[model samples]
Target: MAKSRFRSTTEHTMDSKGRLNFPSRFREVLNQYDSEILMVAPWGKNHLRAFPLPEWEILEDRLMTEGREKPDLANFIRYVVGGVAECSLDKQGRVQLPVQLRTKVSLAKNIMLVGMIRHVEIWDKEIWQQDNEATSENFDSFNEQLSQMGIF
Candidate 1:
């Protein structure tokens, strides 16, 4: 069986048609989950996240159940699910990121495919460099806080 969580990073290019080669390891994980379709959406201002359809459905269901009683949760649902693009891998395991999404995140030809446990995130090389620097600076504080939650 494939691992339950994805973890790794690799660089790939977006074609002129806005299509990208999904990492082969990620594809194997998707196959284990029995899905070729994914929901791709903006994550923050720097990256796009791809969620396997099956995985996304589970998250959507949870949000639906929880959002009914929380107004902010509902808004989050709209922000994420509302803008999601449903994409399917072609015969060659290529998935097309929407043009608008590419523009919104400033994704260029050179990109990075990052397996971030629950989802895979795509990032522009330059943007990833910037974001990584910021995240690294916060790691110590984050680790300290996370330890209190039994995450250490």
Candidate 2:
């Protein structure tokens, strides 16, 4: 499988009113495509997830693959469905995060946008700092363990 070329990362701040000024580089990535996008507050995390419309469709398809008889899948879909919102960039190249998402991520002043292969994760500054620290501390050991699995 081909790896996605959309990986990018940026740190930014959200204003007191919960509006974020997305980085220009990140905006450039979005501009390369013509499509609406969906931003969602993923479960069990204090962050927002942004997915291009096409990518979101793929995710939805994957979710649907879970058997209808599975209660966990149903519950997962309910939470994900309610947390997702369609968004678009304004002239200033900013997207207004929904109030719930902003609150979910505790996004007030400092924010970080971390690009994964197919999506972006929005995190609060303090939380990102702590998470980064934890990841850094365990990265070497994590990689070693993964290597043992022959999956690294």
Residue 151 lDDT, candidate 1, scale 0-100: 90
After superposing candidate 1 on the true structure, give the runs of residues whose Cα lies further than 4 Å from its correct spot. 1-3, 149-151
Write model 1 residue lDDT over 76-126, tens digit each, in one string.
677778889999999999999999889878999999999988799999989
Pairs with steric clashes in candidate 2: none
- In lDDT terms, which candidate is top? 1
TM-score of each: 0.91, 0.82
Each model's lDDT comes to 0.88, 0.72
Model 2, 30-145: lDDT tens per residue?
65555645455565467778887777888887777764657677767877767788887677767778787787667767788888867788888889889889989978778877
